[model samples]
Target: MKDIKAIAMYLPQFHRIPENDQWWGKGFTEWTAAKAAEKLFQGHYQPREPLNDNYYDLMQKKTMEEQADLALKYGLDGFCFYHYYFKNGRRVLEKPAENLLKWNDINMPFCFCWDNTSWARSWSKLGSKLTWFDKEKERVYDGNGVLLEQKYGREKEWEEHFNYLLPFFQDDRYIKVDNKPVFLIYRTDEMACFTEMIDYWRKLAKIENLEGIFILGVNSCNEKIGMDGILFSGPSAYWNPIISSNHIEYENRNGIKCFDYETIWKNVMIAGSKKNVKTYFGGFVDYDDTPRRGSQGVAFINTSVEIFEEYLYKLACKNLSQNNELLFINAFNEWGEGMYLEPDKKRKYAFLEAIKTVKEKLESVVQDDNEELTSALKANKGLSGNVEVINTNMEKQNGKFKEYYFLLHRWLQLKEENKNLSKYFMDHGYYRIAIYGLGVMGKHLIEELKNTEIRLLYAIDRNPQLIYPDFEIRSVDDDFPRTDAIVVTATFEYDVIWNELKKKVDYPIVSLAHVLNEM
Candidate 1:
């Protein structure tokens, strides 16, 4: 059961456009409030106004297309727009999410996470008033009367909330398990009666025939606040019963406890059975609630690309050897929280690379025998050998050696998989070839074989927006050359694409590894 897949949540505050612009503090065109709100709403519920100046600037700088690209690049299981409902109960998550869904229906997978929290002057309010006004606003909670928040729900009120949420619950993008839709409760403590609130929800879901489960975002200290939490298991949630905190302190956004993977994971397994629900894990990049909290802010965890990649790879390796059934990630595009895998101007693709590496490693591990650890190691043999051997060696390396090891490991994986389908020369007659989807591995393969005879057929991708040269390109559904063409693809969800291509062509489907070996 260790053969579990990973899922991630994407929160795109198109409203954040202005926020992004302001944070970056440059490169934004003048826009009116009405027009900005209309454009920002795009496919979701309409906003009363464009997000405040901070958010408006963010949206003005980055488009939805940019956001979608960032989600796919990270290999997320799915994405959910942060559908908001407030101010006389207005709702908007459908349009933009649907639009994103339409853009990349096949290759890029997605799902939704309902961010249900209050919108108040105290909650939404950031920084102090007065000349300190020059300072960025910091989100501060008074903790005076948490019970009085307008969004606080009695059991019946919670049911009413879900009633309004029924449309999204029926959609495929809504996360589900065992035929039940998953719903996360943003801040559970806000409920006046924590224990009674959950019991009521359980009763309501059964009565209404709705699949509802509330996931709480518990702060530090690890106290059992009585609601189920999204638990972390090492670097990934491959195994069940992840670590639990009696009370984990919440230090602004993204600033929380940093626990050790080995210690935490072992504890989680035993606790998981007692908890009765599957636990999850997440990897962190850098977190800066500074936008919401100013100079008296929380410390950010420095998860450089190198660290992020290694943490995920090792976590995947460990999970592939476990008995868990499902996994979850912190997020896909929560730019405000700063844990996004999206490509920033500074880190081109540091986060996306980690996601791809974890996915490839997991898939490669699954194709091998799982009963014993030996088969896993054996699967990492030379070229077509087992992946575990390479993983094992990589772990032993110190410091900078890790990067070179991964580069070669990735190279080997491509060469092997490519060899299978790309071997037109030795196996068939050494025919030339081309690959579609010039993503990370595709670009790497092209670089490795720059001097070889296998001419790349015009590289194509589903993203009509990608601009690359030296090859013909087309959408995944477009009719193209398939006769004797040694075709390879670089997108994830290969099974989906493989099935699609099988319907269109008679040629054998080859991988980049197969193509590289012959070269």
Candidate 2:
């Protein structure tokens, strides 16, 4: 059965519960340390518990029970706790996680996602001096926009953190692979400091008489995390703060201001489509951490459960059984950071409903025949919906909505006309044409036809800048006469580009892949 792997619980350490509020309620008003510092100096806010109201308190077993309850209620596959502390205080990450392991003895299974970034306000910390907190609100008078400060653990502090994981490594509930426990590190680049972090982890795992657990680093941080396995960015977009190095500016198809998370999730899957890495599909309910500092003026985490269900459906179609590829969710409950899949007031059971729906659907057809699978695939052909774009003729087009609708339309009509041409070429045993689009389908066709006469010796795109002097690069708007041209589009959207060519070119415009197969 396909595992509906999703994380929907929050680590008790960062989860701050306000005195008479529900678990998901905003506990404190957003205030950064600098703002707190300024406010303290200015007498605006006072500390409730001396040092900080958000003190590390995982000792509360009651909260731990609540955390486990949220996990079970949401149909989450596992839980991940953010491991960190304020400055050089006591080690706080281990307590809550340990508590969960104890709770899981008879309850649900859980795992740990190790976030290795330094605990300074300068990096991952909210309201620290190094983010876009105050300037976005125009409240503070700092340097306006960007803040870049490097506050990581010194050599000793990192060692202490690593050492604390020994017990977690031994715990069977700790998600592991083979015999070794599996630990996920947040920023892969941070692994640079203790070049031997992985080696040390292995050595420790060996000493503990267990198959050493691996430390999977962030996909953005591709540098070796010294573990046996690595974690790929699943469905939810993820960014390696250490890799992007704090370059937060990103845009999506709608030209919306996208954080780095959106960029990776949307772009990376097709970015290196030809690469050979086995990827685990990821899913998430939402990702908005701005609440930590009380900035509620953004759509940081307004993701719809409907969209999330569609993603799960896709995973099910791809044969992601529980015993096979694991579907890692972005979080269980980073409630303070606002990426919870659990039930909330505004949309009670919305996310959990998605999980159950996907789970039930996937389980129902677990052993389905090829015909059923094919029907399912076709039914959800555009489950991601149409990538609608207004073409030059103002007609809307779908599939890969990049450009040239007229050309795309003509190409589809042409393909229908020459649908029987494939058998003709196969009878002749040889045919060839130049191929366009070096994307996923194009690459696959190229590989399949490698030994055949329908060989594509050159690949091209519409982009002029990439058009090398020797390579054939033609823009759709260009008036180049279609000689022996075969318009190979990766998907349906480009069919419009082909239709545009029909109006001008009299020569044969064929399916890019079909012609290549003939060659």
Candidate 3:
């Protein structure tokens, strides 16, 4: 069976924009709100902190590359960026997407979701006070009291919109379904001329010599709007009534709601079972928009890493049965909304690990089943001949399958053990270290070292041309730094690197696999 596609909803609001600077303050970004958040009630977690301990600017290409690496490591199929476009070709928070397009080496598949709602200045009293009022008092602006209105203009603007997205659709990395570029409309019902817009976009796509667009409606509004599929937003949208009843209400806090996180997960699973439409369910690590909403923030309380893992496993199984093979995560990094999957101070990469665990487990089961494997291979290659040979070989090798399973089990165990070994080395004064091979495994090892006291001296690679902004890549034959130790991160040529390094240097050498095996 094919692996389930997991697309995370990505927010590009981490960069500075002129509109945001004017509205908020100089150099203002999402972190401003996120850092300012305070606990609204007892036992309520607030002021969420990133594991990196720095507010990353999205303008940096390195940040985007690291994000892509993390997403791929966790088995995410792609990202659905929240594309913000207002009337008259106006756009905000577009640099990240543009940068992704420009830097071809990022290597992450991507699509767009037109957040077709009007931009409102509702998070603060200063922005919303002037535009919205009730009896001389400021009223809560419900996202529609727009500062910049969203207008669906005539054919010219529609053509312009399609033209703007044409380049992205043409990109090889763009995510598609059945040869059609996948686009999402966040608020399909809000646009009166959505049908016309869809038709125009589809017509434009055909003119560009492409198949029709796979336009999906977000939330429960897809039914009313004639979308090809529905992408559920999150649990809050589906179980609001249950949440409201079980939640805590605060005095003078604008009816801030708080619900048991586990209860929400249970309700979501129950609701998912009854769904019949072609839909993609969303899974969230946690949610608490108090940073943006302040006193009016709603949160799913008691949401631990373990709870999130369970929720993800259930959601993954549900998606597999639904046959959509797509599971949309609520967010990659909506830090202000407290729904991000990025590593945080409280739970560093725990959410990401949960995703990886579920995906690997599910995929492993499929691969281990001989019938499923044969079927998958036949379907993938459109093979009609000599499948018997493959099946015979699989059956003959069945007795040795236990060894393969054991190796797989050891590999998974080593992943965790290697992480602990990294910490041990750091604690024992292995601060200066050189990593061999600047591959995916090296990147993962680098991330592990970030939490420790280790300092990377150089990234050694066989190919000297391989460049990474995060570290200086040097050829293995280059002069070595007087390092405390050398850690080999190459899996394919581990023995080759180890033998070659042992010939040149007398420093304490350790391979990642060696450390894991020792543990």
Candidate 4:
């Protein structure tokens, strides 16, 4: 039932590479930048720490093993590792990936995104000026000097690079679409001899008796020649002045750039809206490079697990149903960029838990739809697939996705800003309660009540035949069990249900909506 693959972008820079050691200093890793970060202003969340202070080194094989376990455990399909290969087969930051390949025991599926940008020490050290967007538009990391240059030699160089990648590509764990290994490269227009290089790779792939590579452009839709697809990079794909109203604005007090997390996600939600067959969608867990760039960095403020799950769930339900392309999350462990899915101190595993929640719910919806479709086929005794009926059912499930978020958001908000349902029940002496109308809202109410001291007696429904293994169900026709109150979920027909239910049971009747809003 998984309609689209969820591949988290991975960073291998957690392990010390020789080039990084020489350029930055000895023992320098992503943890160095993340650990040294300090809050630049009030409300700034900095010095992102891994849970249990697990500042792990990727060089160890167990790191990869645990990472693979975490990813698979939390509904991620694979990892799209950032591959750093340059001209003349000169590569750096490859130890982790090498180990992943070398150690067959680690169960992880992965692909590559060639991060072709040149690196320099100056990108991190922004002196007194600290102005946002002064040089940011030119590149993500702006610096004067270049530590290494990315160049493209002729066919020979292309062949050499392809040769190095062959083993990983050939590995059974490499993700593929239609039997072709998926590859991503940034700035295809800027990658010299890009088309020629892709063509050469395809030729070489064919020689190895494998399908030609499926190369996707990284936020680049410029060329149509050699590229097979396009994977839009979140915020970057959605960034630009004319795109919309939400954009970079500097802090008046400190001249630092700050963005509303909601605003940018609103922009990102529009990505892949048109259902481009050759396009894949992308999203980020969160983006805050302040750990790496300090005040000179760009940050999206006020992000929480609830907000993230809402955005991701909405995006998944909207887009994944229409495309066959992989949905790439910005990163699994780019801690330096502040865009990792790895568990951290403040959030713990809430973000990862959110992924599991969304994935299971989506799959459940899909399974329901398929079962309904099968029932329709059997009833019709061979109709024309009942495609229209399937769409209608899907649309309803989509509405449920919207409803779940809306209610969850409002419920959470009420608990903090106003009187919550739990307090209402306790104040009213409804310690033991029964839910009337065991439908969507009733189920949501049941879940919300679990955090409180209220005890669920049972549920009342017209058709009590429905089986819910989690809780007991009772027929409204039967003598009601003793309870302090009955919370009705049928808000639209609350009056009618109340009149009928009151005649059957001696308990106060209240609408779930009234309880939530009256708070």
Best by TM-score: 4
- Cα lDDT tens digits, model 1, 18-79, are 33254322332222221222211112211212223223333322455554455566556665
Query: For residues 40-121, what per-residue lDDT tens digits would candidate 3 score against the true structure?
Result: 7777778899997968999999998889999999888889999988888898888999999999999889999998766665
Kindly provide the TM-score of model 2 when superposed on the true structure, using C-alpha atoms.
Answer: 0.51
Local distance difference test, each candidate: 0.44, 0.45, 0.69, 0.71
1-519 per-residue lDDT for model 2 (tens digits): 333345433454443433212211334222222223222122112211212223334466675565566566656666656664323435433556766666655455555675544332332222233322333323322232222222333335545655676766666666555555656666543222323345555565676687766555545323232434445444333342222222244433222233433444333222121012232335555654333443321223235567667755664554242132356666554443445564454566677778877766666666554466556545433322221111111211221242234333433544555543344345543355555565655555555455555545355566655544424665645556333555465433333445555577665555543332222
Report the alpha-carbon TM-score of model 1 versus the true structure. Answer: 0.47
Cα-lDDT of candidate 3:
0.69
lDDT of 4 by residue, 1-519 (tens): 446678899988787866655555667788888888777777878879999999999988888899999999999999998898865677888878888889987889999999876555443321133311121233323354445556665567778888989999999999998899999998663443465467669989999998889998887534335778767677666564222223455353254577776767666554432222265557788887776676668776777888878877665654444444577888899787778899998999998998888778667766776654335324332221223344234433543464345445657767566555888888778899999987778877887788689999889898879888767888988878789988988654554576677678766776675565434
TM-score ranking, high to low: 4, 3, 2, 1
Cα shift from native, residue 463, model 1 (Å): 68
Candidate 4 wrongly placed segments (more than 4 Å): 121-144, 241-253, 272-277, 370-519
Measured by lDDT, the strongest candidate is: 4
Off by over 4 Å in 2: 1-4, 14-59, 85-90, 101-106, 122-162, 193-195, 221-227, 232-278, 293-302, 316-324, 369-519
lDDT score of model 4? 0.71
Clashes of each: 69, 41, 0, 0
For residue 73, model 2's alpha carbon misses the true position, in angstroms, by: 4.4
